[model samples]
Target: MLTKQDVHVLRTLLQEYAHAASLPVNQEKQRLWIKLNHLHMERPMVLIDQIPWNEMDVDGSLRCLVADTYWRQVEDNLRCTLYKFRHMPADMVLNPYVCLPRPIHNSGWGIEPVSSRHIELEMGSTAPSREFVNQIQSLDDVERIKIPQLTLDEKREAQIIQEADEIFSGIIDYRLTGLCMHLGIWDSIAMWMGVENCYFALMDEPEMIHALLEKMTEGLIDMIGQMNRQKLFDIHSHVCHCSQTFLEDMPKENDLPLSGNAWAFGLAQLFTSVSPAITDEFEVQYMKRVFPYFGAIYYGCCDRLDDRMHVIEKLPKIRKLSCSPWSEREHFAQVMPRYCVMSNKPNPAFLASGKLDEQLIRDDIRRTIDAAKAHNRNLELILKDISTVNHNPSCLWRWQEIAMEEVQR
Candidate 1:
């Protein structure tokens, strides 16, 4: 049961969402995004994310006003969506629909970190100092990692959607979005065994590392099958892994459900110092187990992946290549194939500093633009990993202004 206040707040947010969805710009954006993803863009597209969103403003514009805990999350999402478009509106598309997770929950991998310590420089930082008590220290320890059992609440799922439709009828649609995966086989393993423990094992205990990854990879592949079997894969989902999915080529007539339309995101953040040969042997090899199940794949993250593009580009169904702040612009731009979109991530540290250094932002974006032009490759600016903006949200507005100008040029 919603309180009068909850009803008022939700209704107000829905009104704005409906109005925004009706705007002509969304249709225009959807078309451009499709062209960009197809690697045939007339110009570049720009977007910003990975924000410390909750702390963007002290003015309470970013504050959660709803009383219910669950509803508060809905309120937060709505506020951020409106705040984002109102401020930047840089190539972001809004729909009259909001996607909700399917009513599916799971019992996680049975093993837990035995011991760990961590400290953060600031609240809400995604990175922090950490240590772990290596849980998988030997060959036998691989058995301790268990596959999570999944449960679907179909009755509850129907109930919630029906209720949402009843509340927001004719105003907005509440659609259910299903699971798309980012293969984090290595990330989970690194935490169970310490990060250094895993890396050292690559050299010191290569056999043990291989045994662990194989077991972990098998479990994840199995999980994907189970999720698909439950009819929980949503390929047309608007947002995927912090980026947008523009094309909607769903499974044709009898095509395999996920195999025809689904996507898999692949990355190994710990491969910073590892060589291309070792990365292929460990990360890429295991990831290939599930690659055939998806029609396309987006690969890489914050860790420097430029040096090893030759290795990953050969992986099956490679679509988008993430160009991180550390990736060499000219080389990656030149070498990245025309079939894939180079998603260049600008350094958010420029925005994180005590004050905005406008010149640094210009230089970074200009370098990316130049690199893309030099190679005649299509590039998209995805400014992310933004942990802070010194409590001044206006910096993002400025960034949008600067980046939009550069990309359009």
Candidate 2:
């Protein structure tokens, strides 16, 4: 259903993206990051804030694409890169191509869908609150949970792929990419049983909690097995949790790798307030079931892992750990040196105040740099979870400038 205008818009963006990809600097930065991830000598890297786009002053013309899902996706990717080019300091590789198969729908899960009541936030509130309608009220509900089955529609997939190929035949390469998986066990269960219930279950119904975790883990393992059998897993590089880490042992093109050769990300932001012992029992133990399937692990998110270093330290495949704003800077600076890349997440709240506080931002960056240097930890400064820029796009650009200057200093 693409009109002449739609095609024109797409071509313009693709050409611009292609030109950006062809830059030699982008390739050089990519090589540098690869070296850094491998523990080779390099300067501390910085990924300009992973802005929350929902809170930004997005351009109106691009917003018009929302009416068409396919075009909207293309627009979003192009818009993201365009913004990065204009402001962010992260490495920008020029190849604008991405391979994704037509969506494969899944059904037949043993557990019934959990319901929740979404509550709107009051004016000025940052995030909306939700009340979980507990679906697993007792032990019997645990037994009802079953493994899920996945099915693919080959004919539909072929059409979708063909359409994508036709749309960008000469503009950009659009090929099929493999399946990517993220295992969020505790968070998934908390949604069904409620976060409070999960905490209480650890004390009152320990056995039941164990049973549920076992079932969920088994279900996830089965899903991975199914994906592998279908040759759905792809060789894709992601940076969110792993911080420029790549899979060294990826399978050859058209071949598939077992979970042990693939990259996996796991985190439990929901368990941040729990004791390490409780976290170990409920979160880490269950995660172990799936972690063995991946070649490398990227752990942690917004949670402060300063106190639970001992627990995560045992994860053999961990290559990067998110040292969020709430994390103890000195503790991570010490422990992460011996473990993995410190994915330092500076507070984005400094920008959320509607004006750029250059001095405060520089001071914060200096403290992190000093701490990481003290212990000789490989650090990747990642500014993320940005809720707002108060409609000032220049705030991000200035922040990136300040970050690069501070890091170079």
Best by lDDT: 1
In Å, residue 313's CA in model 2 sits off its true spot by: 1.5
Worst-scoring 10-residue span by lDDT in model 1: 251-260
Q: What is the lDDT of residue 306 in candidate 2?
A: 86
Model 2's C-alpha root-mean-square deviation from the true structure amounts to 2.9
Candidate 1 global lDDT: 0.78
Candidate 1: tens digits of C-alpha lDDT, residues 254-284: 4443533777688888897799899899988
lDDT of 2 by residue, 311-398 (tens): 9776667778889988889888887636588888989889876698789999999999889889888777887777667767678878
Cand. 1 TM to true fold: 0.93
Off by over 4 Å in 1: 67-69, 113-115, 124-128, 248-259
**Superposed Cα deviation of residue 48, candidate 2 (Å):** 4.1
| All models, RMSD in angstroms | 2.2, 2.9
- Candidate 2 error regions (>4 Å): 48-50, 64-68, 92-96, 108-127, 240-242, 247-258, 337-339
